[model samples]
Target chain A: MDTLNKIINWFTDGSSNKLSYHYFSRKFTPMAFIGPALLVMAILLVFPLLFSFKLSFQQWHMIEQASPFWIGLDNYFELLANKQFWNSFGLQLLFVVVAVSFELLIGLLVAVLLNREFPGNKIIRALLLLPIFILPVVSGLTFRFMYNPQYGAINYFLKLIGFNSIAWLSHPETAFAAIIIQDIWRMWPFMFMILFAGLSSLPEEPYEAAIIDGASRWRTFLHITLPLLKPTIMTAIILRTVDALKAFSEIFVMTSGGPGNATTLLSVHIYKSAFKFWELGYSAASSYMLVFIAMIFTVLLVRNMFSE
Target chain B: MHKFKSWSRWKKGLFFLTVFIILFVELFPIFMVVTTSFKPKLQIWTSKSPFELFRPTFKNYLQVFKDRNFAKYIKNSLIIASITTFIALFLGSLAAYGFARFKFRGNFLLSMGVLASRMIPPITLSVPIFILISEWKLLDTYFSMILAHISFSLPYVIWLLLPFFKGIPASYEEAAMLDGCSRQRVFFSIFLPLVAPGLVVAAIFTFMLSWNDFLYALVLTSSRAKTAPLAVSEFIGQFAPEWGMMTAAGTVFLIPVFIFALGLQKYIIHGLAFGGDK
Candidate 1:
């Protein structure tokens, strides 16, 4: 009873105890704020990550109803020897490069065009954002409908222009190109939004000096705008690249990685392995490879973003 | 503005023409989907021209609602997305405020952890999450789906709201604390209202993330908690080119997103641009 009374007095003594109270609260307040998010992250993210790593080293056929047995690095070795895996990896690289390139180029051009004052600019810019929000499944379905060789809009327009109708998704090359086009159509606005913002926020002093020096518009853009916008461009590229690597819903809806495995992106490959083949262990390994690739880009992004 | 006025007549015409072309290309597919949603089955299948005039019909929508169980899926989507968005916003804003204001030991490392977690591919997480959810017998339930959705949305919310909190002047809180107000009071009354735009952006994004999710819903839920995107994708596989119904369903799925994009255009742009900077 005496000890309890002394402890209470030590804490509640207003003049002498205020510093300790403040110190304890200061140390705890942030934890109270951040603890829930960290808990969720741990349960959902970190746990899954560690579990996946463990699963990658085991052999678990989900359909077998047998316990998973340790298989060492067999999955990784199998992945190395797997032609289909490499094919999917190559296709993913191609998709990322082509889709991001077209999006970046077109997005930059449009951002430059819209950066200036114009009639109905606000409405056009708002409309530009519509594509970004369209569900990927919807985009894929709409594009598939349009790309139908018979009675489709794209074919109809092609016939109008005196060009013969062509099957878009039935063949491998066209299917790859078609998916890339769909992706570019859906994603360019993201790039445009960022680049446009960067353009608008650019300092005017360089342009003012360029005008005084009689530099041509193209010269001014090359010298002034591009350099200043490098950070934004880097940010946009890294973000889009990571997202494109994860592209699944639309392509899955469109082709399901069909046409003799022509459009099997790494994500589609991972999905097929897990769900279709029920090779849970192998799928976990391949997904980790995808994560490894994504992590490199993420590391670059974090460094680029936080270095300043 | 001066440049536009000083341009030659032909240059000005060319500029407008360029803008028109870009808009036409970008918006054409959206226009096609919207118009096709209104077209009759016969018109959609046997149209002579892409621009052929026809009377609009809601028969496809009627079929989608009457035949397909889109309403239930949409209900599931709404409930799951709303819950995830609410919880994510509350938790994310608190953590973002901590990272922005508090001088903690792992502040930098923890913020980086949040950023790195944001980059984790969902497919990678799907396998373990599926196993764990099923092991716990939580599969096909809204609880499982909501938890999975929060895995991604929480990080995004934190990443986005961090800058908003940091942008607030520290003096505002300092002054509030100097008064009789407590820290919690200052946060609720002064800080949250000031960051209302950021909160709105985070809510919209988190909602959209949950609403548009397909993979986790695919793996996590078999039927009961299936979302609209998964349901809509299933439409394609069930039949042979049901273009009218597909377009109608697609259009319906897009309506909420369209409302969000158009209504809150300013704040989204600000968020995207500001987020891109960091």
Candidate 2:
């Protein structure tokens, strides 16, 4: 009892043992601040991740109501063999590459154009940012309405232009292109916002030097701005790429991966597998594959971000 | 600055024209939705030109509020988002402050862990989360939805706020400590208030994320806790098209965020500058 009391005193009695107390608080303070968030992450994120990882190796159908039986690599083997899985994987790659490329190019152009002093530039930038905050579900619904074959605003404009109205979301190729267009419209501003911020902060010395050397504006931009903006560009692209891979609500609301699976990205495929087909284990396996793909970019992103 | 004055009349006209075209294209869809909300049903279907002017009606908004139980969904979304924002801000700021101020072992790894967690696709976790929520019999509960939201929002809040905390000079805290203030008091009265602008930005962004969330709400809540986004999506699943009510609901759902984004544009821009860089 005496020993226990002394040990407790050693911890609590700051005045008696100032050195120990100082060392203890230094270690304890950060943990006190950080521990709760770490605990929450472990419970909500880490645990579920491990649980899903375990489920990937088992065979379980939600509708069957049986226990998840150990299937060992069978689910992975089936996923590898599934034609739809490969198709979705290919589509996922195509979607991310195409959408991100257009967004980067267009976003950089707009940012460069608007980086100059202009009237109403602030309002225009703010207005451009509105789409980023609007709910994806709402955007999807609006785009769907705008793509309606009979009454949509888009087809109406096509008619005004003397072109035949396209059934935008009803056909396979058009459906894919339609979603990509909507995504670009919705996301380009993100790149613009980041690149615009980067552009605004760039040192004026480079432009001044380039002007003294009589370098053309285009050449100066390619040589000076591109190199300086590389970090911000990399950050924006990787962030968008990871987010684009997880694009679900917009696509789900727009086409529901429809026109006969023409637009099924990996995320949508996993969703349909779990909910529509009730293949829980299979979906878990597919989701891990998605995590794998995202992690590659995420690793590069983190390294790129922290390297400086 | 002289470049503008040096430009020819045609070049100046072209510049303004380009700006006008960009604005019009970007905002047209939003304009369509907002205007469609005010259009009478007959006008919506019969109007040949999307830009045609007409007398606006409040009937769609009236019906959405009276019949569709949209009020409940909005209430759920408000309750869940507000609570999640509050809790996330509290916990996330503390963690961010720790990561910024302390040079303890594994700080970099832990901070990176939080960043990496933020990048985890929510869809990837939806399956296990759904099963877990159901197992705990938490489906359709506000608790379940808020938990799921906080899981995503907390990491983001931490990531966003870390740079803000790091930007503050250490002398402030040291000065306070020497002035007989306890560490807790110093953090609350000094650090938090100093980071108030950051807190505001974090609050708005976190609230916006929670408010706009769809997947977690979809998986975790069936009816009682269904969010505004989910309810808006449900408008399309019905047999008959309800564009008027859908647009009205969407407008209501988005108006608060639009106001936040525009009204707080300065702070958001500052936040984005930091958000993009680090």
Candidate 3:
């Protein structure tokens, strides 16, 4: 930290030494720069995270309401060995992978389609964005009602086409599937927006060159369009994966991590452990673990994106 | 590689159809919500008959606005989002200017740390925030939620502002300095105007994140300070979840966000991805 301060001070001195760049020589006020942000962020977030960190070391289940035993690492030890915790973590991992992949593919296809110079494409593009704005809480509950066997739109549509209603939310396999499908629907619009932005921004030079080379449309897209879109595609995937791993509002609104905890991802699990079950310490530990997983994926995403 | 004008008529029709089908699927859920909002209460609950709207009434909407606290919820959301955006932007821009114009120590770590804060799932932090508010005796107050939201929005603000600051040529600031303008004067007159557009986009994205926030509001505030999404979620409870009331609330909540997005969709498209991969 001293080295850092010295390095910064050196830059300040050098710039001030030059009469042309002396405005920043305001008598060394470090507080003015990082102050407001620090105050806001510290009171709201950093303090809270640290608060949760210390709270996690104590026991807070039914044993204590206001005060707890300072059982260092006990909660984490139990959580680490807990079968249910690992299972839910595994579920979240799977959900993030599958959901992000599907969203990226569908979103890319929509972007490609929207990128075309069609007559009614503007209206389609506008309409395509409707889902991205819909609040996840409402979407989740609406789907809960929609997936209702007796009154759901899905079952109703199925019967109209002479098909039986699939037990959409109650059954284990279908419940998770239903949430994934709903998430895809909710998320694809934003993905579409990003991918479309990328496609639109691409210079026509590469495609033009490919055309002169007698490359087929498929070949040009594969060799040129896809390669050029690498960054945007990574952006969409990273954004989707992070959100998917933290999928809470929808699942909380819809399933509440129920039907024997089959749909309880790590986040919902954290919610249950902390708020619903009143185990603050255990929940805090679980949340940090959750943060660890998210960071891992995020780092991997950054690495992959930069690698290309 | 070929222009669409050279395509055969049959192929053109196929492409059009393909586009339509994809858009239809993409839009089906939103379409359902809009259409359902207009349908009468009984028609929605009784899934016995679908695709048929026997009666239409504004009663559900009327109830949403009049029966419950939809109006209060909207007012709360608007106030919180607006204040958060303003305060955050004011502070964020100043800090960004400071970091950009001034040479700083631990700048790299601090910047990376700020960005890293955003990567953590919000759910993880809610517990700590809840505890903090409780400790500070701020629970159930607008301040609690607003403060909580600032933490979430700040990282994005810094990240967004950093690039715009970097993009501004340093010669301009140097010139201002040479002209006997103080550092603060240069920031206000010279740099602030240049970064205003980027600031607007940053504010919009931050405001939306706060307005659309559910978890913080859900855990941090009770009924007195509840936002629209939180109020909307209340329609579902342990027993006898009121479908009509919920859908009514949902529609009202959706309308403001939808209208805001529709009006500013272009701004959103251009601006929200400020810190995003360029």
Name the best candidate (by lDDT): 2
Write one digit per residue (lDDT tens) for candidate 2, span A1-308.
35533433343332324575477667776776788789899999999999999999998898886679989999999999999999999999999999999999999999988887667878889999888877999999899999988889999989998999999998999999999999999999989998988888899898899999999988998999999999999989998998898799989989999899999999899999998898999999999999899889879988897887
DockQ winner: 1
Per-chain TM-score of chain A in candidate 2 equals 0.93
Clashing pairs in 1: none
Q: What is the C-alpha RMSD of each candidate to the true structure, in Å?
A: 3.9, 3.5, 4.4
Q: Is the docking of candidate 3 incorrect, acceptable, medium or high quality?
A: medium
Q: Distance (Å) between predicted and true CA of B10, model 1?
A: 1.7
- TM-score (all chains, Cα) for each model: 0.95, 0.96, 0.91
Supply candidate 1's per-residue lDDT for B275.
50
**Model 1: how far residue A180 lies from native, Å:** 0.6
Clash-forming residue pairs, model 2:
none
State which candidate, 1 or 3, has the greater lDDT: 1
Q: Order of candidates by DockQ, top first?
A: 1, 2, 3
Candidate 3 colliding pairs, count: 0
lDDT of each: 0.86, 0.87, 0.78
The TM-score obtained by model 1 is 0.95
Share of true Cα-Cα contacts across chains kept by each model: 0.69, 0.64, 0.59
Instruction: Show the lowest summed lDDT stretch of 10 residues, model 3 chain A.
Output: A7-16
lDDT per residue (tens digit) for residues A31-139 in model 1:
7678879988999899999998999999998888567889999999999999999999999999999999999999898898888776788888998899999988889
RMSD of 2: 3.5
